[model samples]
Target: MKTALALLVGSVMLAGAADAQEKTIRVSYETPPAHIKSRTIEFFKEELEKTSDGYFKVELYPSAQLLGPSEEVAATARGQIEMSAPYFSYIAPVEPLMNIYQAPLVFDSYEQLWKFLETDEAKALAARLESRNLMPTGYWFENPTRLWGKEPLRTLADVQGKKIRTVPSEILQKAVEAMGAQPTAIPGTELYLALQQGVADGAFTAPNYGLTMKYYEVTEAVTKLDLFLGGYLVLFNKRWYDALPEDRQQQLMDAVAASRAFNEENVQKDLAKVDDDLRAVGQQVIELTPEALAEFRDALAPLYGTLDPQIQAMIEQVRGL
Candidate 1:
């Protein structure tokens, strides 16, 4: 009995020591648990914990449970949390180059966007984030931007005289103008109320937000414009990430790479599912006729010409890929 008791105490002490050596990483984001991005993050947690062989543990604080969406980037940079996932636009103020995503209709597909990300310019853009103590681990795609409104906007002319809520993107503002809609820059926090109060007749956003934010309850129509792809990046606190040993760093990045592939495979299908789910709950999803689509496309054709020649060349290069 004495030998058995000693063995038990020794085992407990060993277990405690192992637990003390484990590193805990907390990742926070605002997406609902059912969202694919959220699922990808959960998968990330699973993969990291599995790959680390008891050396690491990841906890997910989703739907702003641990931190609000607006606080995510700053909190991560401050190392208050080891990581956070927020949209590119949310990070753009601190690192303006990320606003390359702010452009409209520049990327026609996820494949093209991935190609653009591999470019030297995109690499440099990511490198710039390190200056602010942020390191992007992986990026998850949002649905393409859509025009959701209280009224059905089936054609370019139909949107005329309507005020559309949009992000503070110069290119997006020009696109809205080209569509004959007055662009209104509404803070995202107040957007639902703005639509409900008739401050804006429509909004430019991903359909996923309509599902998660319950915007379908306030807005009656969604025109699938497919204007541009939007996505969020998972960021690690640079100090925390940089402090990891080489093999540990590679393991974390490998988990991120797997999570990214999972997200890429499922994101588009999940986007369409969100649209369908929205329709089931009484949101009017308007898929414009071919003629109407052509008209809308043509209306914005000149907007592309407004780009600087260098940017135009790059845009062409991205599209050609």
Candidate 2:
């Protein structure tokens, strides 16, 4: 009888162990298949499954199939979703330091920008996400910011009084105002319609958006502003991540590391392709003159004081680096 009891206990334990090994990650984003964010997540899925020997599986929901950008951060925090890659501006209201990501003309170059992210201050700011049940364990950099419009926006005078769609960041809205355009906050899913319906005369986007999402289809011009580097931070439910075994956690991070190579290589290439593609479709690719760039810089200079003092100081410190 004791032998029979031991056999039953062993059967149940084996079942529980099998269950623990099969972890399913559901990741949602608001971009279509061709966007870099989608591509990055696809690579991450492939690497994670392969490295974990199929013990881990990732399910992706793209083009707002599961949740829109505005809903992702709150839903992920509530554990309504396992993962979501929302823009940093969308995360900023809950995590203030994130607001800096949307602020225009901050970091001077990619080297300086990446160096700043490695600093102690940035890590502490990222740590604050966990307090609200969200974990930013990984991130994907989108293309640098630029303005796309229905008409030529080659100079500050040309931008005046135009209605422009912008991100959820207030600093960016101020930047739009500084450029002399009206700022309207619109979700990515609805941007094409917004432009078509004249809800916005112009909008902000990366070169990838013009190529993949077909923003060039609606736009008449692409202005080179070289605004701040925008990003989509992967926010996982903290509870779900903390419950994972240490090995599993490391496996997930390894997958993110492996998936970055494509984005690092292709971001600039996409811009050059976009310039050619836009002209082929008969749209103007506007380059700002030295005088026009100076006007833009002078307009944006005073807006830096609007940041939270701590975030302002952190940015100032990074610029000096």
Candidate 1 Cα errors over 4 Å, as ranges: 1-22, 168-170, 186-190, 272-275, 298-313
Runs of candidate 2 exceeding 4 Å displacement: 1-22
**Cα lDDT tens digits for candidate 2, 252-293:** 878876776666666656755767877887778888999999
Local error of candidate 2 at 11, Å?
10
lDDT of 1 at 301: 88
lDDT of each: 0.81, 0.82
Best by lDDT: 2
TM-score of each: 0.83, 0.92
Model 1: colliding residue pairs = none
Shift in Å, residue 147, candidate 2: 0.6
